[model samples]
Target: MRGSPAGASFSAAAYLADVFKLKLADLHEGLVEADIKEWLVAEGDEVGEFEDLCFVMTDKASTEISSPVDGKVLKIYHPEGSTAKVGEVLVDIETDGPVAGSEAEAAPAAEPESAPEPAAAAAPAGGAGGEYDEQMITNAAGKSRRVPATPAVRGLARKHKIDLSQVAGNGKDGRVLKGDILKFIESGGAEGGLAPAAPQAPAGGAARAPAAVVPGESRTEKVAPVTKAMIRVMEEANAIPHFGYSDEITLNSLIETRLRLKPVAEAQGIKLTMMPLFIKAASMALTEYPILNSSLSGDKSEITYHGSHNICVAMDTPDGLTVPSIKSVEQLSILDIAAELNRLQELGAAGRLSRGDLEGGTFSLSNVGNIGGTYLSPVIIPGQVAIGAIGALRTLPRFDAEGNVIPAKVINVSWSGDHRIIDGATMARFSNVWKNYLENPDTMILNLK
Candidate 1:
């Protein structure tokens, strides 16, 4: 109104801006609630379209919510460290135009009839305090570790000149809580007194002294939402009857091929790894044996074969085990697959993968070999008919066709299939096809389209 055009009669209603309510929708499939990790803006602050307003940590990933319109922050419905259910209003912004999702006013928050069952007890963000310390410090090894505690707790510990790392944590995942810090100070910093232990005498031997407690004393931990989701997934997966197969695959040819093409990939700024090769080979095999990519219905009377090879790769992050998938592996070349894998790995490491990244997985693979595991009997994820685990590579001597000893690089590949549908013969045939592709890269390349 202050800057209205010279002959324009501005009505008060026309000049007034509409308030838009920013609600939290489903970030990922199966996500019911999310922890408001932090807020980047406050009420009365000016926000531009697409600007990040809040950071939310869901069971699957940590994501940033953005403002949809240019506006002033009218209100923040939920504070950081609080949980909000799907469809709940997160914030309100006053905008110039009528926003599509704008509501007249915020809806009353819904309250559950009863308290929801505690999710697999993870450390409650902020715990009994609000605002957490997100600063990361480099450890002696140059790796960064995020200290899980509120700013208040950190301040209290600092005021007392206490080293937080040495304080025994009684919170979830052994997070240092304010109460634990107080107890440590009250106990003269002696680990709040060690646990009592009774000595026992071995048969015909002198009484043995009890082992001393470690620097950080033992304490029970509450499971956070991520761990809770993991627990639920594992519990559901356990109900599926499973049968397994394991074999050592010779990977010399694959390794040679990778070495030859490494520079080509580097030129394109892609870090090519064995996983892309494995995933591509598996996808090709699934094309031939679609049954392996099928899912058994809840009633066990129907089997639905998925068209896309959305293969999931298990990743171990700070939050816990997460299996995010690369969509449509059958449609991507080895290099394309490598690029997608690299993207997923980076996002997974940063805990920023979205629901689309995690959902629609038709087959699963776990490359435990990267972390130094030799053999693994990985449990099959629910919904998928099978999952595979690859073990560490080892050089072993073997006899060639001429009976001469040759050093061969081999890795153990293990598969677990739903016993109800996938028989041993079918699984073996499928594995053989996947193995042949890896063993003979030239043939695999010919088959690639």
Candidate 2:
């Protein structure tokens, strides 16, 4: 086979092998399929090991796959923009490098490890930690539990109001991925195992025909990818049972403190804003009210109190609205948070935010105050539980110590929490604590980490 010089392994001892089949690597592990955005190397082009040979795009992100061996691109199995399954033979190369053990390039090994029989329980993968552990949350029943699911799965459960714990995981490592919950729903299990929902007819008990568009009345345009992403998430977030609480914090002290520090911060190349203060206040509040800093699991039995205060800052960009996070806010100073917030904004503007930047948030701030929103009820970012919006700062009349009317700076703020774990009273109390840190900057200043 090696002497054939046609589609044979390169390990011909003395003779150079003619070809090597390039199988797709697990670059993005959770992703099942990706569209090849472009192929950087053409047939007959020489390529080196670790050189980016192609680009692939998934819904979450786009990744560049590199060549493993120096080679000449001989045949491209998949074209640009074509979908390819993971581990499939994406391309074939001609190289002097050693080739596979056999001629069947894409076929499995002769003695492939036998797969475990499908169990009632989910399959086990490597322990959920690092990336997988991002979704591994603790249940609220005082039990430390890790649900092996993806972010999309958790988002779906949130949308359908299904309890993941009730739905047995069948994915890798008992991972309760999106398909698991979907399968559970298909199996007549929602809240209770096998308790199905009765089918309901449309209003008026009639099947309606699809509505027709009037001629010359409307024009249709393809949905932009960024907007499409926003649509999916906003629809899911709106579907959740939303309950909100409103509160206000006099911005006088916070404003003064920031104004005083602005010059000092500017000298250090930091354009400090009120956002860092709000983030800092929220982080402090989370320490006192851990529930507000948590995202609820699919099952009502648990609220995963996050160990880190990764607070997301929602920003409006020309592309769309993006909320990237500054991780571990509890450990950051107001200045450090401000720096990270600026860095994240730069990344968002440049369209360089990785999926990691857009996820793993324990809490978030919708700082509409920058754009003149007095108070807007922000929809929770899917997967995470709570979000708060800050209103624009305004001057209001207030009584001074001597009973004289005085102008004071204030901003209205509001909280929208998951009613399951965070109650109205809880929101109120948490808001008060959050406001205390802002109104009394000294409290935050004295306790600054």
lDDT of 2 by residue, 1-449 (tens): 32221111111122136676666544444656666766767888766443446655555544445454556788898998577776677777777656644432221111111211111111111111233222323434453343534333444465456665676765533445545665776787664332212121111122224448888898675454456668878888875677888887787888889999876655544557788788888898889898877776776677688899998887765345667788888877776776566545644443434566676787888877766777687888877778998887789998877999988888899789877666788889888988898989998888876
Model 1 agreement with the true structure over 1-449: per-residue lDDT tens digits: 12211111111112134876667766545778888877868899877543456767877666656554457898899998788887777887787766343232221111111111111001112222223233334445564444444333554454456666677666643445656765786679733322211121111122224446677887565465678878888999989998999988999999999999877766554666788899999999999899999999999899999989999988875556778887788887787777666555554544555556677899999987866677788898889999999998899998877999999999999999999999999999999999999999999999998
Q: Which candidate ranks first by TM-score, i.e. highest?
A: 1
Candidate 2 clashes: the total is: 8
> Which numbered prediction scores highest in lDDT against the true structure?
1
TM-score of 2: 0.60
Instruction: Write down the lDDT that model 1 would get.
Output: 0.67
Predicted structure 1, TM vs. truth: 0.67
lDDT of model 1 at residue 415? 96
TM-scores for all candidates?
0.67, 0.60
